[model samples]
Target: MTAPDETQAIRLSKRLAADLGCSRREAELYIEGGWVQVDGRLAEEPGLRVRPDQQVQLQSGARAEEAPPVTLLLHKPPGYEAGLGGIEPGAHASRSRGAPEALTLLQPDSLHAEGGPPVRVLQRHFRQLQCHTPLPTEASGLVVYTQDRRMARRLAEDIETLEQECIVQVTGRIADGGLQRLCHGLEFNGRALPPIKVSWQSEQRLRFALKGIRPGQVPAMCAAVGLSVVALKRLRIGRVALAPLAEGQWRYLRPWERF
Candidate 1:
């Protein structure tokens, strides 16, 4: 890479703006969108310094428009933090030793083969993402993270009304009428719980569909009924289902898909 001379160096966005007769912000958008090339190499930083003699060009069919924000649906595995929550991307320096974060899996290689309709993966898409409806670190299944503000708002606002589906594996015997009590007459944190749908999926597995669930509530509910939760996995939140997504992989949320 050629370092620009201190006396003759100029910011890339400034030069591009002058060359294209456009605003600096537009030039920055073009550069950040991966449209600008400096000396035959892609220049993604608008503040990069360049000399007048260096070759500078825009990619063919380039436009000075901002890229659309994106949302990601991840099949989070157990033992990984579901939300960013003060953790750094790809690193857990601030967290307890050996505690990994699921956000680190949002890399190009981890993108599911059928990760929804084809969409270009950009570095910016990984930044500023906000995780919603966090799952417990000990449990695993579908988790959502998004950069779109409108989608974030929808998830936040509809949290109480939207139903969440979880598949819980339990052990030990249940008290008589325990399943019925689980459907209603349950309390968490000294507060009365609303009636929810619960059914036996198998001899050891139970399917629970409820709204506004709190962390640790499932296990508490099971304990109250003389059942011990052995494993738990969330399968869906509202209309989005986690099927077809392998564990430790992720896909893009479809455009028409809504919570």
Candidate 2:
């Protein structure tokens, strides 16, 4: 079999752009969206070199509109890092022997609902995801990863003020005036803590609603009140809640939903 001349081959995006009468970017999106096929096999790389004789066709119902970047809400289980912090850049490397990264749970099989988000689950959606919202490894609950810059920016800039709701389980008796102190009188790192909402949800469970949560802050607060934290789980961030999402599963952020 004679090898096709390399000089005669063209970039798949260029060829598809010409065939579809669309812009180069549009063609690339189509290819990256897994809607383009070459010789009946799905071809996802727009820069792939193709011979003129090779067949390139768009899948049925394929549209040229820009694909919206995806944002995922994951129910992170305890002991997994919300984001792989500095272990390996952009790689889901385990932080330690027993700990794994929550990013590893973003696979198609871990998608929360069968009838998922308004958008289809494409391989491209998983690429370049950024997780600005970090949950404590020792705690569990809602963690966010986004491919959209707007969503990323919103979460980052608003994090300090955005309210976080957590359910903490404890074992021990509270000190005198501890409930009031937990709300507004506690001092952390030599700075007076702001007023917060802390109340008992049940006999052993306490709910905390506050802003500017720090790593270990909840445990520290519990200890300050003479209580020992048995477990901690975040239930909500800003306006988004972690309900209906099982631990180790993820779902797309709805279009109407905001941070």
Candidate 3:
């Protein structure tokens, strides 16, 4: 639960989303139904945020649901698209491509239904990458895509967003001051970005756990610390990682996959 004024700090709920003129349910309905976003990703948490800075534009003439809620884990290479490839930058064009063979295809996999007004698919889609905040272009490992909305939404979207793992390659040693700054000195706009857990995995390799993120955040973070992002690949979203999948591939999100 969050107060309207507090919208600037965290997730927003259903009633709150309607307050912003979005739709029902925070994750899928609000976002899949079309318009809503936090920091930039299609707004998933209804009560996720209502901050003036948080964009809440309803997709005009958004289509109604036609599939059952679902989730997927895609080994998104440098080139593939994330969700429906919207106005977001990188999706339009990129170098590497991903495989979507893992997911159950465009077929609907219903997760829930009832005598309620209408049933909705809580599809949660993702693209794996090096930067926690991928450039509108840079690319890498696993990307999630799907039609089973609910479970997917829960896994991907939430105030309690799951911890994501990243493997990064950088060019040069980080400055003592810059590394320190990387740990806690940057801010998006004037809003303080989330704190991160950063460490070295090798001479030119580093690992980071961003407590929070702004879309396209990681690349900027590296630049701020004077590090060039040479390559980035995501390992996991929550407990879900790109284990069995190969590059540019996808698979059905199993019932056991939710984090």
Better of 2 and 3 by TM-score: 2
Which candidate model has the greater lDDT, 1 or 3? Answer: 1
Question: What lDDT tens digits, residue by residue, belong to model 2 across residues 147-170?
Answer: 999888987788778888889999
Per-model TM-score, in order, reads: 0.82, 0.80, 0.51
Q: In terms of TM-score, which candidate is strongest?
A: 1
Model 2: pairs clashing at backbone N, Cα or C within 3 Å: none
Q: How should the candidates be ordered by TM-score, best one leading? A: 1, 2, 3
lDDT against the true structure, per candidate, is 0.83, 0.83, 0.52
Task: Show model 1 residue runs off by greater than 4 Å.
Answer: 1-10, 38-41, 50-55, 84-98
lDDT (C-alpha) at residue 182 in model 3:
72
Of 1 and 3, the candidate ahead on TM-score is 1
Kindly list the per-residue Cα lDDT of model 3 for residues 1-259, writing each as its tens digit: 5545763454555544555554454434545553554555665444454555465455565443533444445566654444433212222233334533322332233221221213333333332211121222245665555444454444344413566677788886566687667768787557776667788898888887654445556767787777888887777666677776666445555665555
RMSD of every candidate to native, in Å, equals 4.7, 4.8, 18.7
Off by over 4 Å in 2: 1-26, 37-43, 47-56, 84-98
What's the distance in Å from true for residue 105, model 3? 10
